[model samples]
Structures are given as C-alpha cells and as structure tokens.
Target: MPLYLQLEARLRHMIDSGQLRRGDVIPAERELASMTGVSRVTVRKAMGKLVQDGLVIQKTGAGTFVSGRFSQPLSELSGFSQDMRARGFTPGSHWLDRQHAMAGPDEAMALGVAPGTRITRLKRIRTADDEPMAIETAIVTARDLPDPSMVQDSLYAAFRARGLVAVRALQRLRAGLATQQEAQWLHLKPHAAILRIERRAFLADGRVLDVTYSTYRGDMYDFVVELTASSTTLS
Candidate 1:
C-alpha cells in the first residue's frame, strides 16, 4: 500500500476503536510525520482523507479533531435524555418555542385528534454534554400538559407525573436536507444532510400521547438495528 494509505488506515482504526474519541485533538501533521517516519505531505494526505470522510474535522489555526458520532438502537423507544445518560453523557435542552395551538393537519393525523383540537407544542435544541445534538419539536394534548412550565428536563418524566406514560411508539427515519433554520440550530451549513425522525407515542389506555419530529446532525448520529432469524421455515 502507499505510505499515505497506510497512515490513513491506521488513523481510521484508531477512531473506530475509540483510541481517538470525539473532540480529541489529533497530533499535528509535523508530529505525526515524525512519529510514523513519513513525510509531511503523506501525513497531510492521510488527514485530508479523514476530513473528507467526516471522521475528523480540521480547523484553521486550531487542529484536527475527531468528530462526534452517536449511534442509537432503532428497536428501542428511548428519549433524548435517556439515550444520552445511557452513553454517560449529560443531556440538556434549550427551549425554543412553547405554546398552545390548534392541531394542524400533520399533528392531528399523527395524534388522531380533531383539526381544531388544542395541543401544546414544545420546541428545543437538545444537547449532550453541552454540545448541540438535535432540533426537536413535540406536540402533545394540551389537557395532559395543563402547565407546560412544569416540564423541565425530560418530557417523558413530565408525562409520568401526569400518569400518562407512553407504553408504545412508532417511528420513522429518513435522510433530509437541513433547512436554513435547522442548519442554524444544528451549527451546520444550509442544505446539510440530516437524519429526520418522526415518532408517534401512545399511552396504555390507547390514547395518543404525543408526536415528535426531530432532526439530528447526520455526521453526528447513527441508527442501528439488529436482526435475528426465526426457527420456523417458510411454507
């Protein structure tokens, strides 16, 4: 293999195996060149490939660093707070918009409610360890959230308080182009590819609990699903 390709593979392995964690600054090109007995041009080429692959980022006058990439199990119904905590990261949210409005077409269809039914819509910038991760918007029956102010960190926690725990949920995931507003919130350039997820949650009593639409930074989030084979044969 070429010298640059060899160096690129080594660096890629380090990132994949967590030898280089997210936000960790990589050694300077000169340092890497000396350490690996390669020319500075080879080192630059290796780093450039990593940058193009989104495995690392290069900042002028700063340094190259591992990019943040989070993986989530597609089969599970977990909230943002739960997911982050399971990863040993602090989860937080910054409220963007909170108000009561009549259910729109999409909201009404998802929640199985009338078009004019009042609903509480909450929008926030979700964070993990103080780093922005996603833009989330949640719509719930207004009756369930008489006082939206009472909701603080986790919306799930607030629902539990009202004896409205979500017993099940259906979700869909898609790749979408980020709008200007979404890009601004996620700190990405306009038209950046993002992971768009929509979910409809239900309570034990068969009532629609909430519907949520979230856009996660594509470079920073992944959806994983496991498959198992059944013993029964096809007839």
Candidate 2:
C-alpha cells in the first residue's frame, strides 16, 4: 500500500480493535511524523481522510481524536443489544427511571389507547462499553405490559418473553437541540445537536407494542442506509 493508505489502515485498525476509542485523542501530527518516519504532510493527509470518513474528529484548538460511535438506523428490527454484541462491545443499560403512568395525548394516540389509559413508562440510557450511546424514553400500554420491573437491557427481548409480537415499526427522525437533562445523561452539552427519533413498534396482528422517543448524540452517530432496485415481471 502507499504511505498514506498504510497510515489510514493502521489508524482504522486501532479503532476497530478498540485500541483507540471514541473521543480518545491521538498523537500530534509532528509526533506522528516522528514515530512513523513520515513527513508532516503525509501524517496530516492520513488524519484528514479519517475525519472525512467520520472515523475521527478534529477540534480547532484540540488535536485529532476518535469519533464517538452509536448505532445508526436505530432499528428495533435489528435488535439493539444484538447489534452492539456483534461489534464486540458490551451493551448495558442503567435504568434511570421506571413508573406506571397514564399515557399522554400523543402516546395514547400512537398506541390506540384512550387519553387517560394507563401505561408503563421506562427511562434508560443505552450504553456500549459503558459509554452512553442513546437516551430512551419508552411507553407501553399497561394492558399489554402490566409489570414494568420486567424491563431489561433490550425491550424487544422482554416482549418476546411474553410472546408479544413486535413485527413492524414506524419511526420518525428529526434533529433536536439537547436539553439540560438530556445533555447530562447523554454526556453532551446543553443545546448540542442530537438525533431525535420517535418510534412505534407493531405486532404481527397489528397491535402497537411500544412507543419510544430516543435521542442519540449527533457527533457519535451516523445512520447507514442501503437501497436496491426491485425486480418486476408482467403478469
């Protein structure tokens, strides 16, 4: 490989193997030049590409560092815990709040419940390798899920245990400015950019299983999407 390409691969490998972590600053350009016996130009070139690829971040007065990472797409179909495990990261949740409450107007409408209907409201911060990745506020109809203590690291897992089908999901994504409470939980600053999502998971029989509003740190997350053309035949 060419010199710059070689450097890029090394940096990427460090990130892949967790030798370098999200938000961990790297050696300075001059220091990297000395260590690699490459020119400052070459070192800068390598770091530049990494930043462009979202593998690293650069602050004006600060040096280059690993970019914080979070699961993009945020699809329950994939199962959040499974995805994190696949990446070799320990997934955990520190349940901050759990309570039974009446559904609000929006949540009631989403879950096809009366405005005053009871629901289980659970608040948690999903973490990977003990780093906060997303803040989740979840609501499920008490009629569907009576006991809230049964909640665990994965909501879908709890649903499956009860044979509650979560077949399809409707989700909306928008950009939100972080609030003070959200900032603290997600380890972000107040008013920082966040990826906001409101999702309604459905059952095979078309029952809404749960509704969740989640906020992910923008700098730490990127949603990946793939599109393919469909084939058709004339009848």
- The TM-scores of all predictions, comma-separated, are 0.73, 0.74
How far residue 40's Cα lies from its native spot in candidate 2, in Å, is: 14
After superposing candidate 2, which stretches have Cα over 4 Å from the reference? 1-49, 57-65, 74-76, 229-235
Residue pairs with colliding backbones in model 2 are: none
In angstroms, give how far residue 121 of model 2 lies from its true place.
0.6
Instruction: At residue 61, give the lDDT of candidate 2.
Output: 95
Model 1 TM-score on a 0 to 1 scale? 0.73
Count residue pairs with overlapping backbones in model 2.
0
**Residues 1-235, candidate 2, lDDT per residue (tens digit)?**
8798899889876775567877788999999999999999999889988888788988889888888554354443655677677666788998988989988898889889899899999999999989888898889988777899887787778888888877788888899899998999988889999999888888888888898988888877777555556697545
RMSD of each: 6.2, 5.2
Residue 37 in model 1: lDDT: 100
lDDT of 1 at 153: 77
